[model samples]
Target: MSVNSFLGVFAKSPIKPMIQHMDEVNRCAEALKQFFKAVYANDWDAAETARASVVEYEQKADELKRKIRLNLPGGLFMPVERTDLLELVSQQDRIANKAKDISGLMTGRQLQIPEPLTEAFDAYLIRCLDATEKAKETIGEFDDLLETGFKGRERDLVNNFIAELDAIEADTDVLQVQLRQDLRKIETELNPVDVMFLYQIIDWVGDLADLSERVGARFELMLARV
Candidate 1:
């Protein structure tokens, strides 16, 4: 598509920019899987490449966020409350922000997952990303929801997406606790500083799901007002 045509779409539909931003944010989160895989394999070169992709996606999301905030129309004719949509975009932006932080810190330190914890950590990361993916899907429904006036089947489908996002986040919580426990068991053998950073990384990864859940919560609130 031509640049004007693409830009015209956002002018026509406010939700389009938000959906595009979430797409980049989701890409940032999804990049972590490859990143962690390289980290686990002790391949710094491959890990660096994946981390770069994460950074690239994050930058794209950030740019879209700024544009959306600046150009978001303000009028009574808007499909949803302007404030609510802005708030939702803010929450969505954090997912990408946290993803960048995770990859930047891990890659900078050349961090390695402990042998025993690698499997569990990978699972935890995947489940967290799943929550992010679900959030993107949920947000993608907004255009349809607007069409249906936030009633009927489209609304039901959004509610189901939120419920699934909640469940995925809950799974991450459980996995987080288990990973922490397993980490604790091996903490004594690893360098104390590495152990400390590992715990921090664990918390940050969990934050991905936490942030995603907040996105769903924000959308749910928007739905409730209709």
Candidate 2:
């Protein structure tokens, strides 16, 4: 196909909406950083404001997902399978949904990271957010991938991006294990209920990284199929 024709096909494809949805998901994930800052400061009001941003972005992602599902062209030719694109969006949406769930649960409980674990928790959370950011970078490569017909340097670049995402996720896993061990040491000193919820929050935060990895895996599957 001619370059213009290729570009035209991409314009009508779900790629733009997919990128837009990831943008929203990234925003939702980012808002958590601010939310945690407020939580660390014991500032519920600021934390609530940040949580509201997470909710807003998650809602925006949801709307984009709905439109993408409803408007994905059935008869139009696409570089990837329609089902693959749909599955990708579904995976992307889960990251945002998990972000919403994390923030809502923490805010509702006014949960606080124990002072002893605060520093380690911050590191773990940042690494998890790094995974989401890396996922966004990987997804953003789709336009270039399509332009290059999913070959040559562009495909290699995407492979490198996915590799970086995988590394970030691995780092989060290690951090999660250490944080859990640290939390375990102090659990006896804390209220039993709060300790349980703290562990839950740690798991939920880890889920962010896990979900981001799933997004990378989905993209890898798309590349393989091509």
Candidate 3:
């Protein structure tokens, strides 16, 4: 392929790469949901399958990230600052990282969900996914923002999405706290090591929402500079 063709394979405007990264993050969210369901059911086979998909998506996100960095043009002709684009990608990538981290911890040590924490755990994970989905939707508006030059209805629309994303993230934070407190209530009854691993998993799952919120924040910053 010619150089243009090579770049064309993955290329869109720089913002497109950021959208692609967020897409991977969204996929990770789905994979995580499946993984959690399988875990809750004690179906090792399905859990393994879902875990593999999460890891695969995370790897794909990393590859796209590297390709984005390598192919990003270094010229004033770009739509946004290259540094800002890089940082945005990095922030979005963290969502996938946390998804993979949670899955890894689940499958690595065979961490079983505590009986009392099961309901809380499921709710917390779903809320985290909600936060990420909101972030993905926010990134999906980039093309519209570009068309409107980040002004008028598009600006208001994206700002609204960001606000909702923040609200969802705030809810996730409360869930995390409640989940932790629930975990501690049962901590004395479980294996000490298992308790440790469960705590680690819960913390990583919360990080997913945290990263998603940061992704939304980064996009807002991009809007400011646009």
Per-prediction CA RMSD (Å): 1.4, 4.3, 2.0
Return whichever of 1 and 3 wins on TM-score. 1
| Ranking of predictions according to TM-score | 1, 2, 3
Q: How high a TM-score does candidate 3 get? A: 0.94
Q: Looking at model 2, report the run of 10 residues with the lowest lDDT sum.
A: 1-10
Model 1, span 182-205: residue lDDT tens = 999999999999999999999999
User: What is the TM-score of each predicted model, taking all chains together?
Assistant: 0.96, 0.94, 0.94
Residues 1-226, model 2: lDDT tens digits: 3435534545675587788789889999999999999999999999999999999999988887877787677865766988899899999999999999998988898888999999999999999999999999999989889889999999999999999999999999999999999999989999999999999999999999999999999999988998
Candidate 3: 10-residue stretch with minimal lDDT? 1-10
Model 1 global lDDT (CA atoms, 0 to 1): 0.92
Give the poorly placed runs of model 2, Cα more than 4 Å off: 1-11
Q: lDDT score of model 3? A: 0.85
Pairwise lDDT winner, candidates 1 and 2: 1
Q: Compose the digit string of candidate 3's lDDT tens values, residues 55-83.
A: 99999888878877888777836457889
Worst 10-residue lDDT window, candidate 1: 1-10
Return the lDDT, model 3, position 151.
88
